[model samples]
Target: MSRAGLAAERTALAWRRTAVASMITGALFLNHAVINGWRPALIAPIGAAVAMAALAGLSYLRNRSLREGRHSRGGWVVATASATVVAVAVLAFVIEFTDPLP
Candidate 1:
């Protein structure tokens, strides 16, 4: 495998890790929501799912780039995915501060 391919694989693995974390967090949030209400669980899953999906998309795009020798798309996709993660984090914070729970 070339350097780009190796890098893409490593990034994909990292994305998987993020997905696992998000999944766990989402589960916890679901439990919290069940104990409380729909507000908490809904927000957490939305944020977590977005982040996981972004990471998945990024990894997929990067891997495709590596396979097709289109290295540039990898960078753009990674950046976009990272940005999405940040946005999700911000949403989580917003939910925490202004919880919709009653």
Candidate 2:
């Protein structure tokens, strides 16, 4: 594969890594929520999945642009994905740190 192809593959792998982590988070959260309550524990994983979907979309766009020989706007995608990841992490923290209902 060419360098651009390699780069696209790397980007895809990175996104896949994030998706796997998100899936793991969702599984853990769902399990805990089933044992605890459905409010905070369940919702955080939903947000993570949403972020993962967005990241996957971004990666797809990057790959498509590269394959089409277009100027892949990968930097913007990376930036947006990174920001979304951070936001989801903060949301997860808020859900985790909050006290359970009485």
Candidate 3:
């Protein structure tokens, strides 16, 4: 396998890690939202988690294609999703800080 071949595995692993982190961050924001009755704030992390799942699914498909000797799409989408996750994490933190549990 060429070095590019490893992109599939590495990107997949990164997406998995992002998905896990997104899930945890979403849960944290969800808890805060529930506590403070800020239902709209729940959307940020939910969107991030959904994005993470989509990225993971895409990575899985890309990896399969690569294993079959097809040219894989580059990592731009994964990088974008990672950025989205970071943005959501920041939003979650804002929500958490602004509305502590009483």
Top-scoring candidate (TM-score): 2
C-alpha RMSD (angstroms) for model 2: 3.6
Per model, how many backbone clashes are there? 0, 0, 0
* Model 2 lDDT tens row, 1-102: 888778766766665666566556555655655666666446666666666566666656665565566654567777886897788778777767784654
The per-residue C-alpha lDDT of model 1 at residue 50 equals 51
What does the lDDT come to for candidate 3? Answer: 0.61
**Ten contiguous residues minimizing lDDT sum, candidate 3:** 25-34
Better of 2 and 3 by lDDT: 2
Q: List the residue pairs that clash in candidate 2.
A: none
Ranking by lDDT: 2, 1, 3
Each prediction's whole-model lDDT (CA): 0.61, 0.65, 0.61
TM-score of each: 0.53, 0.60, 0.54
Model 1 TM-score (2 dp): 0.53
List clashing residue pairs in candidate 1: none
Which regions of candidate 3 deviate over 4 angstroms? 1-3, 37-71
Q: Write the per-residue lDDT of candidate 1 for residues 50-90, one digit (tens) a residue.
A: 56655655555555544565545455665776786687677
CA-only RMSD, every prediction: 4.2, 3.6, 3.7
For candidate 3, list the clashing residue pairs, or say none: none
lDDT of 2 at 10: 72
